[model samples]
Each structure stands twice: as structure tokens, then as C-alpha cells.
Target: MTPETGRQLRFAVLDMQVIDPPTGGSRQRLLGLFGQLGSATAYVGTWDWRGQSERKQMLTATLQEHLVPLTPAHFDAVEREAAHINGGTVIDVTFHRLAALSPGYVAAARAAAEVADVVIFSHPWCWPLVAPVMRPDQLLVYDAHNVEGLLRLGLLDDGARGTALARDVVRLELELCRAADLILACSAEDVDGFIRLYGIDGTKIRIVPNGAFAAALSPAAAKEREEVRGRLGLDASPLAFFIGSDYGPNGDAARFIADRLAPALPDTRFVIAGAVGQSLAGRALAANVRVTGAIEESAKADWLRAADIAVNPMFAGSGTNVKMLDYFAAGLPVVTTPTGARGLGGAAGAMRIADAPSFGEAVRSLVADAPLRLDMAAAARRAVERQFGWDRISPATGRLLASRAARRGPAPFFSVVVPTYCRPAHLDRLVAHLEQQRCRDFEVLVVDQSPEAWCGAAWKHGFPLRYVRTDTRSAVIARNLGADLAAGAVIAFTDDDCEPHPGWLEAARPAFDEPGVVGLEGLILSDKVGDPEWRSVTNDGFEGIGFMTANLFVQANAFHRLGGFDGDFEEPHFREDTDLGWRLQAIGKVNFSREAWVFHPPHRRTEERESLQARSRFFEKDALLLRKHPGRYPALFRAEAQWTHNPYFREHLLRGAARYGVTVPDELLDLIQ
Candidate 1:
């Protein structure tokens, strides 16, 4: 919860790109920052990238995972006609059209905004969808990868049409700055650009530099390097590798190298890698240059290993050079224009800055001096491994997000639903625990099933309490009824026989608010005396959190969507909660918390009751549970026939059957064995 408003740090994430494969630096930056944040907080988002239906959620362990699908819009002829008439370039027109979100996405975002504490727009382009839906008190964040208004201007030719197009982008960017409560700029240079060009407040900006997965890269093995060089049909001479996507600046840089730099170094082999090579495909080039169009990552790694040097000739662009980090990670010394080395404090000497006029000289110097290459390569390796890895750099942004996010939103509210039978003592003990709770933003709902209210007419509590008497004796029905009458956004269910910890409600609030999480299972510890006779231990499996009704918290929205546990399972199968828990996993994450604990004592029963429980007919509930959740039953109950029951309890059940002169069926007898 926030230290100021005391709200849980929940997020409604918005993105325009898919980050699972993360093809470029911008995508990697997003995944490094927001993807890791899923480990702690609840976050949900949407992306309208066409044919991205395969990605249901961001690639990570977020509140199980859910994404509201947004419609993908493309630039059409009508939009082009309008752009032509208005004197706007196709680049700006395409951007403007793609930024517009469909009504479906808007509605979902509005609903998410209502409940979430923060709204994150990955880039300013798609933020128009979020602007109108934001609540006044909600914290809004803008992740500025580049000074986009200035960047787009460079994508087009120098003319009034391009300038006019840039002007519109500047206006939208300014609007984004005004809406954002916080801004994450890629580098200090980007921070200055935002303030200088758009006049954004410097106080709200943070310098979160781009990162690479450095640990995944390594210097190539000798045999593998030889094989790769032989396969590419390149000579043993100094091979300079330059890889880039088909962005405008990358094409210009590629053309510059093919037209000017490569011809100067006739003895050297320059391999132009990735989509940028497509721009140089048809052009007449030097015999020493080789263009490979858009290779796979493995192939890219191969080229990085085979090459003697890494080169980037880019002279224009905003944001830090993500590809430069790859060079550092691969133990390659880089020679690039100053623009290509942006954001990394000269990359700790990994990159040697040189202009286009002297590009050939820098390569010749590195090729002539082997020790210089080794020294730069070592520096590059150290820079990536020690400081610039995604694992190393992502935490700072997460911490900033948490600290700033903690200052907004309201305290979480819950409706504690206690279903009681005839045990007034157990109900009293449970209520006493609730009264001493550290977080007081919840109400108690006592759904009494006992005849004439066995909780007593004199029952009382400090907070607001609702005592509802129901005729239904079924646990499923009682929970469903309590859910229907629940006023709080989250519905927490605890058995009358269980004593919840003082911090149970408080511990559960954060998990419920986590992205994609619908159900929260807490640790239900055993507080029983007669272990062999009666077993109530529930804290065994559940991957860490148990789903037993003795301790469970369900988001009211998800609970209602699942119809609050099928009441039919209440009759013969007393595993309604278990069935519901398994089904809930199909929709969203069902998380477990070790902190929210409940102590359940063994119930004292008659010999007749014990015999009835041991009968073959009574074991049908297990078969019923198995049929309802066929796939998850094994994991839920383990491979054992008698799940959760100890060996002593199994023996006791068998003994009870013999004492009552009852013969167990062959199938039922296997459970005791």
C-alpha cells in the first residue's frame, strides 16, 4: 500500500509493441523495466499489434496474466488523401492513424483505470486513448524512449510538409507531458531534450538508460568462429560487422558505408547485417562488402563472433544506442559516430567515437593494433557484465516506479465472509482476530447457517458488521450467497473453525491487486490435537498457497464472473472451493501467500460419525473432484489416492470401518493401503 493515500500499487499497462521476442532496443527497454515489475505488483495491459493474438500476456510471472484485446488500425487510402491535402508526410500520417484506439480498448482501459492506482503509457503515440479515461487522482506515467517529435522530422526529407507534420507531433507530445505525473526518459540527453524542446518539468523525469541481456552473450569459441567465418565465405582479414533494423537512420548509415567507407578499406571485409542491408541490395558496391538481409538472432550472434570489429555509422537519432550494448556484451570493440554512442558515458571506452570522414582510419588503426582491440574488448565486456545487463539495470526503474506510485490512490477494501455452523466459540475466536487487524478498511459479513443464529444475539464487533441468517446448509451456497450480498470489492472467506492471523487481511490486499490475479490462497496451518483421528492440515501443497475455504480471498469481479462456486458440488463433493479454484486458473492467476495464515483445529466427532466418514460411499467425493478437474487433480492432490490425509489418519479410517462392521469396497480399500 501507498505511504500517502495507502493504496495498493496496481497498474494498468499500455503498450504498442510485443515484447516477448523483443526484436529491437525500444522493446527490450520496456520488457526490462515493466516486465520485471510484474514480480512484485499487479499489472495488466493491451497491445493492438496485428497477428499478436499468440501473446495473451507479457512474458513473465504476473498475476497469472490477462490482457484486454485492443483493435489494430492501419493507415488506409482515405488517411493518406487527408495527409496529402493537409501537407503532412506519410510517416506522420501513419503514426497519427495508429495512435487512435478503438472503442473496445477505450472501454476496457476506462474500467481498468477506475480500479488501478497507476496508468503507464509505454510511448506517447498511443497515449491519446488513456488521456480521456484517466481519473483526476490517478498517477500517469509516460515512458519516453526518444524525443519523438524531433525524431520523426529526421525520418522525412527537409521541407515544409515534414516540418508541418513535426509540428503536430510536438503538440501531441506537449499534451502527453501535461497529462503525465511522471516521465521516464531514456538518458540525460533525452531529459534535456524533453525540457528544452517541450519545456517539461525536470523534477518529474528519471534517467533510465536502455539495457541488454548481457549474460546471454559471450565471446565466440575458436572452432565455432572459424566455422561461421567459413560459412559466410569471408576472408581472414579484419571483418567489420554492422547490424541494424530497417529504420531510416540505419538505411542512411548503411548507404554511407557502401558508398564511402568500404571502398577506402579494399583489403578489409565489411559485412552489413539485418534489415538495413535491404536498402543496399540493388546498389553497386565494393567487392569487399557483403549484405545479409535480416538474419535470425543466432545468425547475428554468429556474425558477432566471426567479425573482428563492431561498427555503427549512425549520425542521427534520439534515445541511447541499444545495439551498441550488444557489441559490448559480445566482447567486440565498437567504432561509431558520436550519435551511435549516445546514452552510455562513452560506453566506458567500449566505443571509439569517430566521424564519417575518418571512419576508415579508425578501423585501420584497430586492425593494425591487436592489443588495442583486446583492451577495448575487455572494457566493453566489463561495461556490459558489471553495469549494463538487463538484470543489473532494471531494478532502479522498478524502485523508482514503486516509490513514486506509492503516493497515490485509496486504501483497499475487503468484505470478510465468515460461514458458521453451530460453533459459537470458533466464531468468537475468529471475530477476535479480525477486530485486532492492522488494516481497518474492511467489513465483516457473518453468514450464519446454524439454527436460530448460534453465533449468539449478543455477538458484537467494533467495525461495521452484517449478520445474515441463511437456511442453506451447503458451504457452496453459503459462500455464493455471501458473495451476492458482498459490498466490498474483494470477498475474503474464512471458516468459523479457523483462526486467521492479525495481518491476514492486510497481507491479502496486495496480492488481489496484482496484475491478472483473481484468487489468493493463504497458508492454512494445522492447529489440531488428534492427528490420527481427525486431520485439518491444509498448508501442505497448493504450490505454497492453499485454496481451502478456511483461508481464501477472491476479487469480487472474478468471483461474480465464475458465479461464486458451483452450488452443485456442495452435496456429495465437499470440494466446491477446490473446483472453483481450479476453474479460476483458466481465467487469471491464483496466487498463494504464506503470510496470510489460518489455524484450523480438529473437530471432535462421535464414533458413528467417524464410521460414516470411513464408508465406501463417503469416498465418492474424491472421484467427483477428480472428474470435475481431471487435469489439475493430480497436482492438487498429488498421485496418492488419499491426498492430504496422513498414514495414521488412513489407518484410523480403516480401523473405524472394521469397528462398525462395515466392509470397504475394493476401490475404496486401495485408498487406505
Candidate 2:
């Protein structure tokens, strides 16, 4: 820990490229991470001596820099190798060369890793240089901007060499994954890929998403927008703008826009900015198209302000687009492909999702309608404020660092709490699953709210099982009653309908070791497809923010501190867990564990009348919840509305209802609306 800020640990970042200008996604993430950790040093490699002095001056004030100058001969050799690889269909040639570090660069990275408490490798290319020097005690973190192997494979054609290259990349990536203590993925999709492809421990991975440095970009006033537009040249026409570095994906998008889209929409002026502008240089562009090569950081906001709509016609990309975030921050309505929208999580709602064939029309539609553009721009800006704001995202990263520092001795004993209401079969199955848990030092407490004692037979289980009966019919009251009786230091909660995975307790218990973490929620996977409830519950985007009672864990002391769940939410089971989560979050951090798995099988409604009544009760409870949290209601309502109307969501709802023999009346649909 540093002397000034005792909580934040000192971090040293090793990167093959100097992140002075912070143009690309990798550099942007480096700047964001270092900005969050005040006391940090960055060891960057310089390509040549031409701009060595200028590069040093361009380093961000937040980071202490060490630039390792590379000889021209060494740079040429690496460039030659990259050029050879570029002859094949490898997408990110520049990124691949970073892995080929010289001996001098390796020594500098090793020396820096020795003094730092945590050493972060910006990309897998920097991994080998710092991995050899990493001490066992020092935490090694890999900030995976994208799944490099998958990106390469996507760009490659089907052939023997492609297969071999793909195989080698996967093998290398797996080794890098195993070497790091923690891996920060840019998106949940990357996390899923790692788990599926490499079988890496999910607990060691976190979603430290790419976000816009909007705060760093000065807000463009109305006068500034007008002035910038005047300086660029008089333009009353709607401008479709895109800005990106000279990466393959960006170059592809720029070519597509200049060759394909711009000709069709001749009325709209297409402005291509950044290094990608060079790719469109000699092409016969439409009269409306303009290529502005590499605008400075100071002029970025002005250019964005002058544009009417931001367009990302990306067909191939692995991670979240930082340019989309920048567009939102600039209050420009965006139109992008689903590929470009990947890893943006829920914030993708703000942008118009389209495919390659329909992308031009999407941009044209936004340009034609001023009202729609304004609404989208407003929503986009709001989404950035609520979700992508650095204030909200940075602390989550800091918590990861703080957790590493707070990890202690042997795991604490756990008290697993299950609140059931007249569900004997579900409770019995749940107990059987608990019996199969890998960790044996846990007690199961069942608080039954049934009129009669239905789960009394669970006492015969192999583990310590405590069954209690209560006359009340409230899930909240039952949870509070069970927490009071719990003897362990940690209190874990799961619905009676949920079946804990064999390693569930073993995976969730380690989170408590992290400092300031009061509550933990495990990944709740649906046992069956087309389960309507599973759509929102299984969304990885809601990892840190949302809470689900079906799979929740909280510290015993924190449970008592917050007075358990609110009694007002007892009758209506809806939002009761959410209300408690809000309170818990206020006091301390509540983490999400992708490893702590629980399978929630959809429960079929035995009686149609009861099902309608339950749905009505859910709506009633939701209304009360909205009244309680007035400020949060609008965003919650918008999110739910968006989910409800989504084609995939609707298909699930219809299919699940039919499969489960559940009937949805018109009244319920109207009520939901």
C-alpha cells in the first residue's frame, strides 16, 4: 500500500508500445487503469529515437514513465517478421509483434516488476517479458483487451496453415492465462470464451470493461461546435462520422464506408478520421465523403460535435468499441453493427443495432429524423453517466486490487440459508445437492414458511441441517429468522428451487477473504432453455450491480448491520432481494462470482389461477419497489421495457410458457406494459 492512499496498492504496467497519445483500445485501457491507481509506474517500449523526447512529454500525468529505446536495427527485424506474418491473413499484425520483445526490453520489465506490488501486462505480448521476473507474492494481472487467438482465427481463411496458426495461438493464450493470478477481460463474452476454450478458473477472471475517457474530453459548447464546423468548411448536410486508429477492423470499416455506403447515401457527408483516413486516401470517394487524417486529442471533441451522427460499420471485432463510448459522451446518436456492439453490455441499448447490408439505411434513418436522433443522443449520454462513468467503473477495479491485499488464511465456515414456502420436493432436492458439496464445513438452515412442517425429514442429511417452521408466509421474514440462528461467520442464501453445483460453496467462500466485500452473488444458470426468468437473471452485464435472491451470499456481520431484508417487501417476493442489495451496496461492496454456480430449473405452475395471482402480486410488489426507490425507477423501467420488447426475450417468454403449460392472459400483458 502507498503512504498517501493506504488502501490502493502500487501497480507497475509492462507494455510493448508507448501509450503516450493513447490512440487505440489497448492504450486507452492502460490510461484508464493507471488513472485509477495513482501510485503507478509504466515501462513502455519506444520504436525508434526519432520522436523519443516528444514521446516522453506526451506521457499522461497520472503515470510515472520509463521508456526503453529500441535500436533501429532491432525495430527493423521485428517489422520484417510482422510483414512476413501480414502476408498471411492474420488480423492484428502490430499486436503480434509486441510479443517478440528484445533482451533489453525484458530486463527493464523485470526490474520494474521487482519493486511493484502488482505487475500488469497490458497485452499477452508483454507477458513473456515480465512473467520470468514476477515473484510468487507479487500479483500478476493480464488485461485481455480481446481474445487475440479468436480474432486471428476469424480473419484467417480455412487452410492447413490457418489451422496450425490458430492452434498455436490458442496454446500460447492458454499458457498466458495459467500464468496470471488474475485476468481482467474487456467483456463477459471474453470471459465465456476463456472458460469454454481453456477451462480457466472463472474466479480469477473479472470484467474490467473498456470505457470512454469522456471526463478527459472537454465538453463542446454550442458556440464551439459552430466554430469548429465553420473552420472545417460550411456544411448544412448531415455528417456520418467515424474515428479510429489504422487497425484492420477500422480499415475494413473505412473501406466499406468509402466504397459501399457513401455512394448510396450521397446526401450525407461521411467523415473518416484518424489513421484509418490513410486507408481511404487514393480511393474514388463520393463527393459527400471527407477524409481527415489523424486529428489531435484537443480537436477530437470539436470534430465529434460537428458531426450529426456517429457510425461504426464494423463487421469484425472482438471487444467493446471505445469509439462508441466516445460518441455517446459527445451526445451523438450512434448507428453500429451487432459486432461493433459486442462487450458494450446493456449500454448497447443506446445505439441502433444493424447488420452490414442494412447499416447504411440505419445511418440514413438517424440522419433523416432529428427527433429520434435527439432521443437516442439523450439516452446514450444517460447510459454513459449511469453505466460507463469512470467514477462507477474505476472503484470496481480498485476493489480487485484491494481484495488481493486482503486475502488471508483458511476459509471461514459457511451457513447456507434456504427460505422455502411449502416446497418439500424442492427443499429435499436442494439438500441432496448440498450433501454433494466439495466443502464439508457448512451447515444448512431451512426456514420453512409453510402451515405445516414439510421439510422436517431434511434433518437426516449428511451435513448439519437445521429445519424450522413458521406461520408467516414471507420470504424476507424467513431469511431474517434463519440468519439469526446461523452460527457461521458467513451466511449464504439460495432459493429452495436452486441446485448448488458441487463446487458452489468452494468457489464462493474465497470472496469473503477480500477486504470490504459485504455480499456475494453467484452465477445462476437456467437448467432449461426458454425460461423467461433466466433471461435477466443470467445476464452477465448485471454482475456487480444487480442482486438475485436465488443465489446470494452475505457476511454474517453485514447481514446483522443492515437489519436483514426490509419487512415491507416480505409479502411481495418481487424486489425484496433487490431492496436489500441496494442497502448492502450503500454500506460496502457486493461482488459477483461467475464460478459459484447454481442451476435454477424452471418451476411449472400447477394451477392456472395461482399463476395469474402470482404474476399480479409481482406487479404490485414492483410498483411498491418503484415508489421506494424513485430515483432508480426510471432507469429500471427503461431497462425492463427494452428487455420485454426484445425479439429474443419475447420468443423465450412464449416458448417457456407453452413448454411449462403456463397460460398468459391479455390482462397480464397489459399490466406488464
Task: Supply the global lDDT for candidate 2.
Answer: 0.69
User: How does candidate 2 fare on TM-score?
Assistant: 0.63
* Prediction 1 global C-alpha lDDT: 0.68
**Can you tell me which runs of candidate 1 are displaced by over 4 Å?**
4-8, 38-54, 63-101, 108-114, 157-161, 407-673
At residue 486, candidate 1 shows an lDDT of: 55
Write the residue-wise lDDT of candidate 1 on 1-673 in tens digits: 4677654567666654546566777667766666665333333344433444423543665431335444544425325544653633353334434534455545655666667777777666656766676787777888888888788766643576556666777787888887797777766557767877887755556556677787677877779889988997767888998988878789888998888888888888888888888888779999988898888888888889888889889988998878888888889988888688766642434666678888878888777778778877887877676546777566545545665665334423788888777878888888888888887998777888788676343566776676767555656656655664555678888888788888888888888657999888888888454355554456555443226888888877566544466533443325677777877787789988889887877544445544435433434344445544655654544444453544444554444343221344555455456
Tens-place lDDT digits, model 2, residues 1-673:
5434464566777766666667767677766666665445555554433234323432554466667665455555555644554554232333344434445556767787888788887767666556666788777888788886787677553566555666667766788899887777776567767777787765566666677776765336778878989988947888888999887789999999999888999999988999889787778888988888988876777788888888998988676788888888888878888778766643433577778888888787778888777766776776566556555465446545655544444533898989998788988888889999998888887888787787355457777776767655667757866775666678888999888999999998889889999889888887444544333235345665457888888877666544466544543455667877877787688988889989887544444533433444344344445544656644554555634544333344444343222344554346344
Alpha-carbon shift of residue 434 in model 1 (angstroms)? 42
lDDT score, residue 583, model 1? 70
Instruction: Tell me the alpha-carbon RMSD of every candidate.
Output: 22.2, 13.8
Error at 115, model 2, angstroms: 1.6
| TM-scores for the candidates | 0.56, 0.63
For model 2, state the Cα shift of residue 414 in Å.
7.1
Give the candidate number with the greatest lDDT: 2
Question: Clashes in model 1: which pairs?
Answer: 42-514, 42-515, 43-515, 274-294
